[model samples]
Target: MKITSIKLPGDISDESLEALGNDLENNSSTLDIEIPLNELQSSLELNNQQKDLAGQISNKAPRVIYSTSPSILVVIDGEPKIQQNAKWGVEAVVNTPFTLVKSGGSYYLHGGKHWYVAPSAKGPFSMTTTVSSQLRKIEEQSKAEASSENDAAEKDENTIYKIIVSTQPAELIQTNGEAKFASLENTGLLYVSNSSDDIFMDVDSQNYYVLISGRWYHSKTLSGNWEYAASDRLPDDFAKIPEGSPKDHVLASIAGTDAATDALQEAAVPQTAKVDRKSTQAEVTYDGEPQFQDIDGTELDYAVNTPASVIRWRGRYYSVDNGVWFESGRATGPWVVSVNRPYAVALIPPSYPVYHMKYVYIYDVSPDYVYMGYTPGYLNTFVYGPTVVYGTGYYYRPWFGTHYYARPYTWGFNVRYNPWIGWGIGYHYSSGWFNAGFGIGHRPWGYWSGGWWGPRSYRPAYCWSPNRYGGSYYGRNTVYYNRSRNYNIVNRNYSGNIYRNRGGIVSRDYRRADFNNDRYRNNRNPSWSANRSNNRYNDNRYSDNRNDNRNSRYN
Candidate 1:
């Protein structure tokens, strides 16, 4: 059934209705559903993704497994890496995805609805009415810090979840109770409507299929010995999934489809810039001494301790900071900007954490400057065959030493792709999900010198911007600067230099005063609007879908 509108009870508080309206507006990709308030019963249900509304029909308590973070990976595959929160006088579970802390011989696992308590780290956890005040304070502080970004309503007391804790690579696949199937029109495939996961069953073999990071895995039943299914080799019925259908999001994962073709085209467009060799600088800071790890199957070693993507190739260190390439003789460098892309970088496999750096390309070089460009791949969006997917499907192991260093992950943050914003974390998953507790040094968890790498800062430019097509909250929105695709990078307001200089990196006495002229000449804010020509994907179909409240699944 096509979900065009949602019906609500008339008695809903104005504040609650307002919040819901704002949420639907922000996530406009989900079709416009009219929230009509009819006199109804006590319980309420809503599914914003599929635009489904099942309200006031029965008193059955709806249960959902809302994962706090996508697969929360702890270093080892067992008990989590626990650390002492001195101020709170409790041992905090620092590694796993959930908000778990221990005090007075009892461990508390904070779910969105209720706190589950157990005596040990491994628990037959049971629902608890009371918890330590310290745990309560920690939870409150987390919510307060995230208050600016998210105002997620709490789940009712009737909400239930089967708590599963693990340190290894694991995913939580859940249904309300039992799996329910709904058929796609004209296609012989049946999809699991009750679950958030992309699960489908083939009628012929009754085999179940799951899509993760552009790779499909199939099994005989819900619980199975799953095996890989190639996207190109998938059954022809997959291509029959309609354009505006509920399960149409999966089209991007299938090879040779229109959605997949669009994604590939987007990945080809690069964010280009020209840098001054003398003024632009680079630096690297390690947790301790510089440590190196081999990029399997390549003659390259990447710096493991620092957030910077520093590579050691043939005794020279190369780093890419905000799409500009820099090279130095020493590991801890007296560095200078470099024009040549490291040859070994191309050889690094996708499974490696820094593999994304391979996409950073050096386009041209002049006597005093360098021209560089990077595709969306540098920002963790990659072309997987005919499609572009977020993050390398491989999970790189995180490094934990004096300071914890997290690697880029494929899953966990509820990443969604859109033609307008590129890729962004869902609002429900974006806010305060990573800010659960402070890291060891009293800094934000996963803090790094480079903002975009790892969990240091999860805010993508588009998430906070008022405009629909992203903004300068990250750097110049790639689209905003595309008008000057051939312009020198220094002419723009780019703060990419890692080294701290006496009068800031861009010295006032610098000869090229014309570098500041572009802003005054154009009278355009690089952070905001762009010329219509620069917006390559300004198609009427996309605008019509947004303006008329219709569901057009382009991503």
Candidate 2:
């Protein structure tokens, strides 16, 4: 006799379902329509008993176990289960499948036929509600499989990834304060960190798992929940962290006292230099006209000719064009013109300094000393040492603020106009000559000397080019320039071109009569002396190199 399908009452409990299956096998020889009828009557009785037990458990109200650490706990049916490991916060409970089920207001874990409740991923657990209908179906399916297959499925549930042993260390790059671990040698794993302190690398699908406090954890996504990994079952990567690597503590925990002393004694060096990784390129998206260029020092692709030329650098979007800077919180932007430039952009090294440096001088105004000819009240309290240091060559460290160091343009570059003071000049190197104004005597060879061609007594007027509707508002078209009685405003065009009020064309090549040498090579700006004096004023230790031409490209 063969039982094709067993149709039981819809309200039958999971326990009753299991028992009914058992009874069918036992009485197979005596199988008939009468056998199922007998078993159904007995199953109904057992279902009622299970319901009563469930009610009792619910009424008891799991007891809360308070822990000093961030972990929480509860007692269900007199069995204590921890939702979080006190040391590591949330962690996977032993023998519990790594599946989370959400019902009502709380999240529960499916432990075969049982349901365990926890406030979060890391849980102090307690057996609470009955198996949910969704979970019950899964459990029922598992029971139908053969015993050998069931055992194999159970083993697979505990295993996270297949381990592959490797001898080489994973190559890592630091960006946005997290280490990005990529397999440069094709170890076939990619991992990023959510926490700077707790970083792990995977190799051959195993090893180099992270151990925090004492518990082991693994994750596929950078910000994903760290599932508990058994220490005994951990892959070989954990054992391979070079002895002197910053992750030496992880090795010590795994290898115990038997860890190699030589590896531990190696000097701990911080990886400050940004590594060039092939996989770190930003995903580029074009909204309008397509313009492409490679941004130096980063894997970002930039659009330079677009109306709002944008580049994604270090996971942030920065648009630099038309002498104004804009930033966005996302990859695609309704970009906002940054009044005070972001600290992260200031930290960009010299390799990508052109775009950022063009605007750095605008923020150089201070109460005591005004570096930029305009914007009197806007002070630069963040930047330090615009000074030349001996060892690091040129240092512009931010001594005490959240601001990133915005280094002055110490290197020489030829341009007809002073980008620091002129508002109309497009900030690009190629566009500087076209928008040239009267020479401000702010030479590129060194710092600005106090002598600007514009009237010293004049106050700067904030001018903005017309927007799409031909109206002026603070935007990418805005610039701050000296507006005195001598220069009367003429008609302004819709394209933001300023025509001469007095009819004579504004000279593009207004060279300073006081300087005879070519503007490109000659250091005609008197500000170099002021910069030299100011450099010594901040730190007298570097006064000996006052005359040293080490930093000069001309020398």
Candidate 3:
């Protein structure tokens, strides 16, 4: 039994429904995609659009796009926060045309349904595409199975904190097993722990940057640039933390003196000489930073590995997870870092930026920022500098279209193809038919034609590549010229139906799925969805009619 799916306009004939399914099975995936003659011919004839000498868009092989497909069990491998904020992993399928992916051992059903892995190899895993009585039962089953699997499987190392600083001037740490850096400052420590562990971390030291990257800096270190006292947060109270690790539910009051030895004295004076003592449990951690002074702390809770020298942001004590000392503000969080600083700092309202930047670390002090840099034998300079070994993305911050991504140039096209099949189809149909269907883009795995101008065989050879050889895209209005209301239609193709390629990859534009998650990926032409909000034309009705392909190949 081959499984087929379709989304119809509320009411559809059994014939049309059967036709759609057969079309998918016969023409698409060999695993079981069918198609009918009527829809197939109509779809093909609709694809070939004869414009400036045959525009871009030719047939290419479709891929095996298997969405959750009402599967039995969706195994989340060790639970690594699959639906993370696009910082760790790609977006799991939340909707149709889901990109094939797995996270935390479980796959995201079209991006949402969380299914668990089965125990006995593959006993059972099923769900319902439609929201009916059976669907609810299956959904529960899936959840139960997942929970069982979670209990049995070994989880990913979430919130790992190794003793980065070992009572030495130089100590290193790692983030989510990725980046690495040294907490050179005598006073430095990372705080915060959550369920997910594959978090990246880094210390943003943009302010103290000297001759770090390629650019030769006149300054040297943080102490040279900013106000570096003997210690930043050392206070005038009892100092020196106890030797053992912090146990749970123990009201441990730590204090900080200007000097470690001095702080130790204050600790000795203790209840005898202390004045204006905190009536509450609000005791300071090392270096005078206040932690849950009131929270009862038993000794077995935290393995007091290193001294406390954390960057206090907002009210949370954020620490890096790995080698790269990134930053966080929540103090308590699944911090998604914005900046992967080998050394970054947090700035306050009265922030005194020792260097030229804002808010200290990047990305709202989320979790540990993954360092996008080069490894020793992995990165160097061949063009920029003979020995160029500078950081690239350190300063490059691209938001989801809100920030500027690395856009050297942009290519646009008008997919001028007709969607309707007048009298017949196929060879006699001629003039307009696209391989990947009529309306698609080279960016979205659609074909490219240099507008019958560039090299005839101008196929993209690289990934994340734009068709520079010369090509054009057709607009949804290509069929009716903005006048025909009966235009937007999806019929059928000969060689397996349309399939989804990868989305939300690394792109020059932040809004480009290259950078954004599928949650932000743009659906093609969109006007036919019957919803006004789904219409792309509403935003640029006038500009599109002129020539979106940039090459001016079409009217």
Candidate 4:
């Protein structure tokens, strides 16, 4: 029998409910993505808006745009961080995601397939046939590095995308030539079939709609300025998008829909644990000395120079590593498992960089053990209003002092949510999505992997990589993003204590048949469940671990 769906009773016991959640988590893998040819062609072909923006920036010296087809967007912060390429006697642009080098007053950007050149650091770059011996050596080294990445899955040259170089934040939205609309059966909405962006048009209003992070934005036309369309104000047909339709995924962004409701219920379910304080220890490393930044509306200060989510409140320093909380007196510490986290942590708003830490909780504290759990929000999945959203829709600037400490971003990488993979990046298929081939170690993955801080001994048991092009280097190995589930907190395994050998991994061992034997399985404790204050938000609106009222915040 094909089990289409199973309807469990709403009043299921906590243990049975979490056991089912474990089953779902174990069985679920990332959605294998294949980008449409139209979307791929559209990304390569710049629209009038992009062209106008390029022209506007051309007047600004060393702040120009470079265009290439099916290319990865290489973003640089302010001036390029140039480092000595002593082997080739060239200065390499070390800070950006891709490999860019300066040789003889000209800049060359290598995009795995082709190298682009221009007169300045930033440029109206164009393809050049002429190549210097030094730059050619760099290209050879890059290819050799790509070859050694995963021999079984070597990147084909045909799959290589050209490069798009940008100094400021920019996202590409293009329709392959002109916009093509496809009508949905029995629905009054027409969706743009030629674009990767979730675009739709209401037949009644003739207004264009776009979905981003579960928020609806509307415009009179595709090129016009957009305004937010509240979920409640959206047309009734948005909720009626039929299941399995090409644009049916948009239903999750619509309030009161079955898809949105399912997402909300899933968002409340957490991966819980009984932590042994004596055995579990969290280590935090700073780039240089420890630095702190105040979280808006909270008295607490978070460590901005470290990847480990550490906060200082009332002179006490606390760190949440992998779902386990640890505390110490000093910023750098002989850390011990924490019994109680700061109450002020819940006051953290979406704007704060460490706002995700608010989702990490401490439920009960005994002498030797502290019961703790973290919701999907800790992994950047949040229950926003009536539906669940991937990110907070706020851009947290990455710290680039001595070492780069990257914060979770809302844009740049096209982020989308799938029930199977949680939040994954959506991009033109086969396009080099942050395919950093220049230097192996100095990539965006390394910065995001908490290279600046974390439990040093921990590593992932396995990697769940469904998308070949989404592969990113984490630590020493190539861990591919099923969108952006790379280095996910839920993907790790735990033994004696949760934080003991906590490492970066997407452990396939987590998918075992026996949920009872899984150390990291969702555990529900009677003590914690009764005292739910630990998981409560300031407004007492929703429970992080339990299903709340079905009232739609949008309505």
TM-score of each: 0.63, 0.18, 0.14, 0.64
Cα deviation of 202, candidate 4, in Å: 1.9
Over 1-555, each residue of candidate 3 has an lDDT whose tens digit, in order, gives 363433332234446667878876676655554667765664444333111111111111111111111111122112122232232133332111112224344332311242222112121322224343433443454334333322211121121111110111110111223222333222232211210111111133223211121121211232232121122122211122112211100001121212222212211110000101111011112212223221121111110111111344334344322111223344333343223331212111111111111111211111211212111111111011112211121211111111111110001111111112111111101111112211111222222211110111121110100111111112111221112331222222211101111121111110100111111123221111111211111111122111212312210
lDDT-superior candidate, 3 or 4: 4
* lDDT, candidate 1, at 452: 27
Tens digits of per-residue lDDT, candidate 4, 238-311, equal 88776656666566678987667666765655545666667776667777889898876568888888767789
TM-score result, candidate 1:
0.63
Cα lDDT tens digits for candidate 1, 1-555: 333222231233435655676777677777765543531111122112111211111111111123332222112223466778665678866555456777877887664445678787666567786977777876666556554333322211234444555444444444544777888889999987765556799998889887654557688866656676767778899988865465766776789876576566656655445567777775567888899998776779998887667899878888876666777888888777775665556656676777777766655455765555555767676765556666665556766676555676565444555443555543332233334434444344433333323323333421322122222211223312323342212111212111111111221111111222222234221121222222222111111211121222220
Give per-candidate clash totals. 2, 19, 101, 8
Evaluated against the true structure, the overall lDDT of model 3 is 0.20
Misplaced by over 4 Å in model 2 are: 1-100, 104-107, 111-113, 117-125, 137-330, 333-555
lDDT value for candidate 4? 0.54
Q: Model 3: what TM-score?
A: 0.14
Q: For model 1, state the Cα shift of residue 340 in Å.
A: 3.5
Error of 2 at 377 (Å): 42
Q: Please tell me which predicted candidate would have the highest lDDT against the true structure.
A: 4
On a 0 to 100 scale, what is the lDDT of residue 210 in model 3?
Answer: 17
Worst 10 residues of 1 by lDDT: 53-62
Number of the candidate with higher TM-score, 1 or 4: 4
